[model samples]
Target chain A: AQTVTQSQPEMSVQEAETVTLSCTYDTSESDYYLFWYKQPPSRQMILVIRQEAYKQQNATENRFSVNFQKAAKSFSLKISDSQLGDAAMYFCASSAYSGAGSYQLTFGKGTKLSVIP
Target chain B: DAGVTQSPTHLIKTRGQQVTLRCSPKSGHDTVSWYQQALGQGPQFIFQYYEEEERQRGNFPDRFSGHQFPNYSSELNVNALLLGDSALYLCASSSHMRLDQETQYFGPGTRLLVL
Candidate 1:
């Protein structure tokens, strides 16, 4: 069984500032994927960024990036130059390929981010 | 292209009643996955469907069942619902043949409220 943990229940950042949401996980699979999804009030789970476990370089998508320390099992999301729209619930998830197409995502409890303008 | 879609955006039900939620995958996507997001918690995987068959499932019980169609669309059915079933039901879609199969796009989700 794979477990993902998000330590911060809630976090706040000022407009134009940066924020980092923490995440950790435990997985026995040799090959896997990690992801960060953002859900706003619209109730849609939007894919923010992703990191392949085999990659040593971190994943960066514009203002969104991830600090993935595979050995430590830590995958944190960083939002740079945060805007009001960045305020949302962020979730870190892991999916291991357990053969025969087992790519189910194990997610953390999520961190509610608030951006103050 | 239209992203993933779900029907009956919101629903209200009572305990013991059964409910079904619908989902349509994104264009070109051939796989669909269901997840349940409880209040203030992350979404938990319920199951995944591909080739009109259930390929993977989470820790959910048998009461939570699903069906996939030839068009890559899907439906989630929960029988003998309890108040604990109240939560946002999200449908995600991906492609099994793609190199980046790890990426799954999600729908707006169907919010179910069980009283």
Candidate 2:
């Protein structure tokens, strides 16, 4: 079974600053996918970014990027030029690439991010 | 285009009761997955439906069941509900053609409170 862990329970960042949310996972599979999701007070879960385990290069989307360290089993999310809209509960998730369990996602508890003006 | 959509934004039920939650997959998507998100916790996968059949399921008990329609819509049914079942139910959808790389789009989720 794969388990994702987000050690940071809460994090805060000033507007226009940068912030990093830590996440680690224990998986025996060599092929898998990692994702970061954001849930605002509106209760909608939105995809922030994703990283493929086989891809050595990290994934970046707009202001959101990921530091994927396969050897360390670590996948952290970095938010640059953070804005008020960035405040939300961030979740780290993992999934297998194939087999019957491919559709299921294992998620971490989540990190509450606060953006201060 | 509209993303995934769930019915009954909120629902209330009692112990030993039954509840059914509905989901409409996003346009062009052929797979629907259901998840349960406890308060202050991440969403836990319940099951996934593809081609009107259950393709995968998580560690949830048999009390949690689901159905998928030809239109790619889905429903989650819980029997003998307990107070522990109170949580937000989320529906996610994605295309099977690119299942490995495609990201699942999520719905606003239905809040179920078992009293």
Candidate 3:
């Protein structure tokens, strides 16, 4: 079974500053996917970004980016210019690349990020 | 296009009771997956339904069962609920397209409180 680990249990960043959340995973499959999801107070889970194991370049979306070190099995999410709206729980997930019915996403414990004004 | 939706938004039940949760997939989607998110924890895969059949399931027990209607809507039923079953239940939907990658849009979860 594949397992994802989030080293940071709780993190806080000042408004307009930058913060990075660490995540690591263990998977024997060569072809897989890594994802970052955010859950706010509303309880809705939103996708932040994703990275393919076969891709060398990291994935970036707006102020959100990922440092994907495939060799080290590390997939960290960096939130730049953090705002109060960025305060939420971040989760890292891993899944296989099977074409159909591959909806199972093994998730990490989660890192609660707080944005301080 | 409406996104995935789930209901009832909140539920409270006692131990040894049965509870039913519903989910409506986004338009044009054929697959729906369910997840359980305990407080202060990440979401865990419960099971997935595609083509009106259970395609895959996670480490959950038989106490958790689900059904998929012909319209692609889904229902998650938990029988003999336990206190540990108290958590946020999420439903997600995704279309079966080759180039679409694996983009699973999620619904605002239903909060289940098992007393």
Give model 3's docking category: medium
Task: Quote the lDDT for A59 in model 2.
Answer: 98
Models ranked on lDDT: 1, 2, 3
User: By TM-score, highest first, what's the ranking?
Assistant: 1, 2, 3
Q: What is the lDDT of residue B49 in candidate 2?
A: 90
lDDT of 2 by residue, A44-78 (tens): 99999988888999999999999988989999999
For every candidate, the chain B TM-score is 0.99, 0.96, 0.97
Instruction: Indicate the TM-score of model 3.
Output: 0.95
**Which pairs, if any, clash in model 3?**
none
**Candidate 1 pairs with clashing backbones:** none
lDDT of 2 by residue, B1-111 (tens): 978999999999989999999999988888899999999999999989988999888889999999999999999999999999999999999887774534788999999
> Could you tell me the interface RMSD of model 2?
2.1
Model 1 regions more than 4 Å off: none
Give model 3's DockQ, 2 decimals. 0.67
Superior by TM-score: candidate 1 or candidate 2: 1
lDDT at residue A51 of model 1 (Cα atoms):
94
Q: Tell me how candidate 1 scores on lDDT.
A: 0.93
Which wins on DockQ, candidate 1 or candidate 2?
1
